[model samples]
Target: MLKRFVVLLLCLLLLAGCDQPIKSGELEKVGLLVPETINDQVWGTKGYKGMLKIQSHFNVDVYYKEDMNSEMIVERAVEEFAQKGVNLIFGHGNEYAVYFNHLSEKYPDIHFVSFNGDAQNENTTSLNFEGYAMGFFGGMVASHMSKTKRVGIIAAYEWQPEVEGFYEGALFEDNEVKVEIEYVGHWDDDQGAILYLDKMIDEGADVIYPAGDGYNVPIIEKVKEHGLYAIGYISDQADLGETTVLTSTVQHVDKLYEVVAEEFDNGKLKAGNLYYDFSDDVITLGEFSSDVDKEFENEIHKHIEVYRETGKLPNE
Candidate 1:
């Protein structure tokens, strides 16, 4: 009778464990907080893609909130996720970094991660990609394709790393090339992009690189109107310009998440800010769709290969 009682209690214990909210021991419930709708395809969408990659590789129960525009909305979303007892939370944008760090402190037991993290917190880990490498590659494309040797860059913001990197890359590739920069102030401002595009075209810029999100539409139209080549970001948007797009700087956030997920699962979550630079292969350049000169391609490939291996480009 005692033996039967022990067996029954053990079975109940197992069942109780199985019924727990987050999987016991190793398995965890993961929550991803995105700044915008998953269709944004610029930043928020990229993070969602990362979340999907993480889910596919690991045994994790994932939850996400989309189209969160305001900080209050983001805070509420994080609180809601906390109430659901998520073990890990991914705040998908740099703007959400401080909020995520704040929430991580509030809920001390949970692990928090921010993409493009700028905050420093004990319980929070931030991941940022090296945009300079991407910019440099883009610069090379612009330098090679520009008939006037004059390139224009329309940025979402001056503070964004990609903007800084773009200039740095362009200068590194060719300081003699005339590069004009125009900040659109916001990611969604099409009017701002149009204003810059008009100015650049009037100034005889044969090539333009649109770094802003939906704001690229006006720039694309301008590129068509002026019959000029343009570089694209986020997506390989060459087709959108009738083959005028030279190349794109692609951020594989999904692949990045896959790396993070595997590391966390293996108990390799490092503390503090984690920066993925050019050497880490975190940022990559898309294929040049233009009829690139064979000699220029070879030269660019050689330089890229050297940079990838040495983590430092020659002369720049």
Candidate 2:
């Protein structure tokens, strides 16, 4: 009778252990917050596409709120996702980093991710886009395709790292290259971008590069109207003007999202900073126009090879 009692007690203990909650690496739900609408076809769209890829791959429940520019909206969205028991939350831009830092500690069970920003807390992780390298690629294409040896860039702001990188890359290609710069003070200032583009064209800038978010559209239109060569940024604008547009620098955000999701599933997601660049195949150049010669294409590939091997730009 005592032996029977001992066996029953052991079975009861095993059942109690099975009832205890176990934390696994399996992800169920995810949330995304974007500052602009998903239809922007650049920054916001790329993020939306990444979320969709994540959803398709993991079959996880994903929710997102676009055009969330205000702090209150961001906070509320984060709170709602937490309430909904999301395993992870992603802020598509640096604008949401502050909120992620504040809420991450309160919701220790959930992971907070910030794109294009630095991590501020233990529960938060960040992925920074290498804008400078992207600019370098654009400058290389522009310099190689310029006929007048005068390449111009119309940027949203002065002293931006990406703009500086473009100038450096142009100079690297040809020491005698004349590079012009103009700052429009805002990313979406169409009037200012057009005025500066005119000034650049008048100054003998045959190859123009626009390094702003929404400013590329107007500049590309002007480039087509003027029959000048232009290099695109962010998304592929070659379809915008087939012959006039040389190529574009593209950000492969879907790859980054895949890495994050795989890491989370493997229980390797940690709070820290993650850097991605040309070496990681995160920042890349889009399809080159047929106008680009074989020799120029070979030269561009050679530089890319050097960057891949050394993990540094030519001018770095």
Candidate 3:
């Protein structure tokens, strides 16, 4: 295992330079930044809810700035928070990671928290969800629920863990299943997403997973028009259509905010990057649709329980 040891040593050396120490400060005031409005029923909404939880839990004043995708806009919002002496700031998405990294040195007293991206500053932390586990479960549901023995997935980027998890999970459930995955290349490209949807439909895909944040709602609505099955991503989308949505892979962003606030309040919050998983109750599957029978649901739960205890999914 000398080769493996050498590789591990190199990786550790690479990380050592950027993994600076963090010190948790008082939970006096907090600020949140979202790229879009909180009414989107997805990522932004979850973050808003999380901020509210932090506000209620800590009894501190919380401020939020929407429409923060542009660097200029984000810098302005952060400057405002800095001026107000906000101690902890949450950037709703990975897009804000760079801006936070660049500003961390300037705002030495403020600690920044964001999701799913590169975070290296001593005052910055990235909260990445272990999404593949939930994706595996969603894939199993889609494969088992699929009638044509063909399934499809639409995602913004191939780098997403859920896409591969769904692919493998489908095949694990049924070796004969055909799985097609399409990338829209951009998160908000609704037209491109729909075109991919049409192509998947034409190819006899009966169960689909739309895994993008900005366009999942419209894609699910279109999936309903075709009377097909879908596995919702990031949030509980059963309200979209109970019959069409088999289940949802959920990320409980609000709970995480509470946890972070609690940690900081208790002087336990750390920096660099923190990962949340099924065991942490952060990444999970939402309630199944009525279409999912009790027997199949129980089987999925059994697998999830085993994973939670043993850290090994069915495929492993």
Candidate 4:
């Protein structure tokens, strides 16, 4: 009986030790993998800002590698971070989901996070942005402001969710508003984006919304050169074309990173998918340009109040 009691006590102690949470300061190293140049002032720059926020808030060491476009480079960067004993590995785009899903098992000790992705794994957490809401906001603005009764969207690909939201929102605002959508088949195709922008302009689209990652640069420039109205995405791109860009649907990635970092510090971070939208205030529209009239701004504010009250967008 004495020997059996001792054995039971030892087992309980082992279990307790095994399940211990990490100490507060022990999780000190963070790694970020960015697929593009951090100065794009859009997706990549937002991610870089998020990393800086994490570093400042958590007082942790942060390391990052930009322009990790290929699979090999991504794999190599992740492995290097893991070998260096990083507490968390943040992959800053949907493209990193595949690699995170595969590598999380190999590095069981570290947590993996995929931004704007749907990756699910034992050690991985995915975060998807509310792109639909962004589109809806832009569409609303375009619908109200388009003098030609026609607006346009040039997307990187035919992702139906965002595209559909833009379509629905435009028509919801004014059923007579015609929205033209064109997919350039790639994210960074300046020439293709320009070609589509010209086509849409030729079709009498006065307000053009470009939804590609960095392609907005050329599209905004084209819209300004052609004296057309434009909507920006991912960041406050109003400065990209001062008078042309009416507003932008900004993604507050730094806030997302802050939330994640706080949860991690408290040992409350879980492996699953987390979503952010307008309801959470992580997704928002930038300040309206002076070109937007007070009445139109009030109308948009009314819709925002409804969304806030119901936790749903207009018609959603």
Which candidate should be chosen as best, given TM-score against the real structure? 3
Q: All candidates' lDDT scores?
A: 0.76, 0.82, 0.90, 0.83
**What are the per-model numbers of colliding residue pairs?**
0, 0, 0, 0
Which residue runs of candidate 1 sit more than 4 Å off their true CA positions?
Answer: 1-27, 171-175, 239-242
- Worst 10-residue lDDT window, candidate 3: 17-26
RMSD of 2: 4.1
Error of 3 at 223 (Å): 0.8
lDDT of 1 at 265: 68
TM-score for every candidate vs. truth?
0.85, 0.86, 0.90, 0.89
For model 2, what is the error of residue 239's alpha carbon versus the real structure, in angstroms, after optimal superposition?
1.9
Per-residue lDDT tens digits of candidate 2, residues 203-222? 88999988876678778988
Give the per-residue lDDT digits (tens) of candidate 3, residues 1-316: 9999999999999899568845444787899999887888887889999999998877888999988888888888989998887989999988888888998888888889988888889889989998888888999999999999999999999888988888889889998999999999877788999999999999999998999988899999999999998999889999999889999999999999999988877877898889889999888898799999999999999999999999999988
Candidate 3: C-alpha lDDT: 0.90
**Model 4 lDDT-worst window of ten:** 21-30
Error of 3 at 221 (Å): 1.0
Error of 1 at 252 (Å): 0.9
Tell me the deviation in Å of residue 270 in model 4. 2.2
In terms of lDDT, the poorest run of 10 residues in model 2 is: 21-30
* Winner on lDDT (1 vs 3): 3
Q: Over the stretch 1-316, how does candidate 4's per-residue lDDT look in tens digits?
A: 9999999999999999989965675365889888877888787888889889989987788899998887789889988897787978888877888888887887888888887676779779998886787788778888988999999999988863567777888898899999899998887788999999889999999998888877888788888988889888878888876768888877888788878878877778888888878888888888788898889888777887788678688777
